[model samples]
Target: MSLPRARFDQFRLAMMLLTRLPVGRISGAVPAMDKARWAFPLVGLVIGGIGWGVFAAAVTFGLSSVIAAILALLATALATGGMHFDGLADFADGWGGGSDRARTLEIMRDSRIGSYGVLALILFSALLAAGISEVASATAFLLAGVGSRLAMLLALVFMPPARADGLGRMAAGKGEASLIAGTLVCAVLVILAGTTGAFALIGAGLAMIVIGHSATRRIGGQTGDVLGAIQLASETAIWIFLATSAH
Candidate 1:
C-alpha cells in the first residue's frame, strides 16, 4: 500500500478502537494496533476538539463554568465510551487490593468494581471535572486532551508490558519514533496554547512519567489499566496546571 493510504488505515483503526466516532468502513484486514500507536494523541485531539465545542457552546449558552465543565467531561466520555475510565478503575482496584503480580492481574481483569476502584474513580473524576470548571479557553481544553493521550502513548513506548500478551504490547513496540511522533503533536498543541500551555504540558508529562515508573515497580511493567490511570492523571494534571497558570 502507499504510505498515505497505510497511514489512513492506521488512523481509522485508532478511531475504531479509542473512540465512538463513525469512520465509515474499511476494506481488507484491520490494521494492527502498533501501526497506529503514534496516532493516539491525534485521536485525543479529535475527541478533545469535540469536547471543546461542547464546552464553548455551553459557555456561550449562558451556562455556569461548573456546568460547562460537566458538559465537557460528558462529551469526552461519550466520545470514547468511557473505556479509559474503566481501565483507571481496574488499575486502582488491582493495586489497592492485591499484594502481588498474579493477584493484581487477576483483580484487574475482573469485571467488577471494588472499593478501591470506586474511590479512585470518584477522586480522579472530581478533580477532572473541577479542572474543567476552570478551563478558560478552547485551546487549554483541547491541549489537555492531546497532552493526556500523548502521556498514554509515551507510557506505551517507555514502559514494558506487565503481561506477555495484551494491548500494551500490541499497541506499541517500545520505539522512540512513536514517542517523537506523539510529542510533535503535543508540541503543536503547546505552541498554540502559549507559555501556559507549555507549562501545563510539562507538568502533565511529568505526572505521566511518575505514574509509569510507579506502575513498573508495582506490577513489573505497564498494563492497559495502568495506561488508563496515566491518562486520567495526566489530563487532570494539565487542567490543574492550566488553572494555576491562569491565575
Candidate 2:
C-alpha cells in the first residue's frame, strides 16, 4: 500500500478503537495496531473538544459552574460511549479485590460491577469533575483531554503486558516510533494553546509513567484495563495541574 493510504487506514482504525466516533467501516487488514496507536491523541482531541464545547455552551446559557462542569464531563463520556470509564471500573474491582494476578484478570473479565468498581468510578469521576470545574476553560479541557490519550499511547508503547495474549499485546512491542509521532502531535496541540499547556502535558506524561510502573509491579504488565486506568490518572493529573496553576 502507498504510505499515505497506510497512515489513513491506521487513523481509521485508531478512531474505531479509541472512540465512538463514526469512523464508518474499517477496510482491509489492520495495519499494525501499534502503528495506529499514534493517532489515539486525535481521538482524544475530539473527546476534549466535545467537553469544551458543551461547557462553553452551558456557561453561555448561564448554568452554574458546577452544572457546566458536569455537562462537559458528560459530553466526553457520551462521545466515547463511556468505554474508558467501564475499563476503569473493571480495573478497580480487579485490582482492589483480587489476591493474585490470575484472580485479578478473572475479576476484570466479569461484567458485574463490584463495590470496589463503584467506589473507584465515583472517586475518579469526582476528581475529574473538580478539575473541570476549577480549570473552567476550554483550553484546559482540550489540553487535558489530548494529554491523557497521549499518556495512554506512551504507556502502550513502553509498558509490557501481564498476559501472554490480549489487545494490549497487539498494540505493544514497537511503540517507540509511535510514541515519538504521538508526542510531536501532542506538543503541537499543547504549545499552540500556550506554554502552560506544555507544562501540563509534561505533568500528564509523568503521571502516566508513574501509574504504568505501578501497574507493571502490581499485575506484571499492561492490559487494556491498565491503559484505561492510566488515561484516567493522566487526565486527572492534567486537571489538577491546571487547577493549581490556572490562577
Candidate 3:
C-alpha cells in the first residue's frame, strides 16, 4: 500500500479499537495494533475535543467548574465506552487480590470487580475530576487526553506483554514507526502548552516508568488492563501537574 493509504488504514484501526465512535470500515485487511499505534494520539484528540466541548458548554450554561469537569469526564467516558476505566479496575483487582502472577492474570480475566478495583476507580476518578476542575483549560484537557495515550503507546513499545495472547501481545513489536510518529504528534501538541507542557511531560513520563516497572515486577509484563491503568494514572498526573503549574 502507499504511505498515505497505509496511514489512513492505521488510523481507522486505531479509531475502531480505541473509541466507540463509528468511523467506517477499513478498505482491506486489518492492520496490526503496532501499525495503528501512530494514530492513538489522534484518537485522543477526538476524545479531548468532546470533553472540552462538553466542559465549555456546561460552563457557558453557568455550571460550576466542578460540575463541568464531571460532565466533561462523562462525555469522554461515553466516547471511549469506559474501556480505560474498566482496564484500571481489572488491573487493580488482579494486582491487589492475587498472590502470584498466574493468579493475578486469572483474576484480571474474571468479569467481576473486587474491593481493590472499587477503591482504584474511586481514587483515580476523584483525582481526575479534581484536577480537571482546578486547571479547566482546553489545552490542559487536550494534553491530558493526548499525552496519556502517548504514554500508553510508550508503555506498549517498551514493555513486554505479560500474556502470549490478547491486546498487549498484539500491540507489541513492529512499533518503531509508531514510536516515531506518535512522538512527533505528541511533541507538537506539548509545544502548545509551554512550561506547563514540560511539567506534564515529566509527570506523565515518570508515571509510565513507574507503572512499567511495577507491571514488569508483578505480572512479568504488560497487559491490556495495565495499559489502561497506565493511561488513567498518566492522565491524572498530567492534569495535576497542570493544576499546580497553571498561572
| lDDT of each residue in 1-247, candidate 2, tens digit only | 8899888898888888877779777577777787788888877777888898999999999998788999989888888888788888888898888888789888987889999989988998998898888877766876777789888887787788777776678888754777666677677767676766777777787878887887787788888888888888888888877777787
Ranking by TM-score: 3, 1, 2
Q: In candidate 3, which residue ranges exceed 4 Å CA deviation?
A: none
Stretches of model 1 off by over 4 angstroms after superposition? none
> Each candidate's lDDT (Cα)?
0.85, 0.81, 0.88
Per-candidate TM vs. native? 0.96, 0.92, 0.96
Tens-digit lDDT track of model 1 for 1-247: 8888888988888899888999988788777898788788888778888878988899899999889888988889889989888998999899898898789899999989999999988998888888888765777777888889888988888788888877876885667787666688778878888898998988888988887887888888888888888988898899989888888
lDDT, candidate 2, at 217: 79
Q: Per-residue lDDT of 19-106 in model 3, one digit per residue for the tens? A: 9999898877888787788788778888988999999999999999999999999999999999999999999999899999999999
lDDT of 2 at 33: 82
User: Of the candidates shown, which would achieve the greatest lDDT relative to the real structure?
Assistant: 3
Predicted structure 1: clash tally: 0
Models ranked on lDDT: 3, 1, 2
- The list of candidate 2 runs beyond 4 A from truth reads 193-195
